[model samples]
Target: MRIVDRAGASTAGCILHGAVLLASLDGGRVYLLNGPAGSAIAVYRLARELSAFDFPRGLGR
Candidate 1:
């Protein structure tokens, strides 16, 4: 599945692992609580995508 921001931005890059034990979105930041180490691949990918947004702006972080 492809992740998406409130603005409908494509956050699919954030999906680090297929397992995705846990995941949450903190404003502009997408928090993946627990997942396999291999998920790091998606972390960086998300970082690149999220960089465009002002993370933690909403969700009352």
Candidate 2:
């Protein structure tokens, strides 16, 4: 898949744990945790586009 729009904050870091993908941006102030399908192909397709935001510290697990 390709990125259709080139807008938004730059990605700072990314980590994959099992099926979950954690993406950090804006100097780690913002993050996006995505859990796509278990399969590789399905994950790739679902990751085409995702939104990120600052997760509340109190809400973290």
Candidate 3:
């Protein structure tokens, strides 16, 4: 699913670009954290192809 739409891209879901393997979490929850130009999308991004690139990135370092 798209977290934001600024590229006027009518796409839904991600592009799986530059993904990462996050440490296992509680598993009972679905965490949604995105920043670093959609770096957070790495995990599921590389898999599901999630993306926030078109949207404005937020959250400070």
How many pairs of residues in model 3 come into backbone collision?
A: 7
What's the lDDT for all of these models?
0.41, 0.30, 0.31
* Best of the candidates, TM-score: 1
lDDT of 3 by residue, 1-61 (tens): 3332233332233323222111111121112444446444444534343233422332111
Ranking by TM-score: 1, 2, 3
**TM-scores of the candidates in the order shown:** 0.28, 0.24, 0.20
| Local accuracy of candidate 2 as per-residue lDDT tens digits, 1-61 | 1111234433332332211222222222223344343344443333333334324331144
Clashing pairs in 2: none
- Candidate 3's displacement at residue 61, Å, is 28
Clashing pairs in model 3? Answer: 14-49, 14-50, 14-51, 15-49, 16-45, 16-49, 20-42
Model 2 reaches what TM-score against the true structure?
0.24
Give me the displacement of residue 60 in model 3, in angstroms. 31
Candidate 3 minimal-lDDT segment of 10 residues: 20-29
**Of the candidates shown, which would achieve the greatest lDDT relative to the real structure?**
1
Candidate 3 scores a C-alpha RMSD against the true structure in Å of 12.7
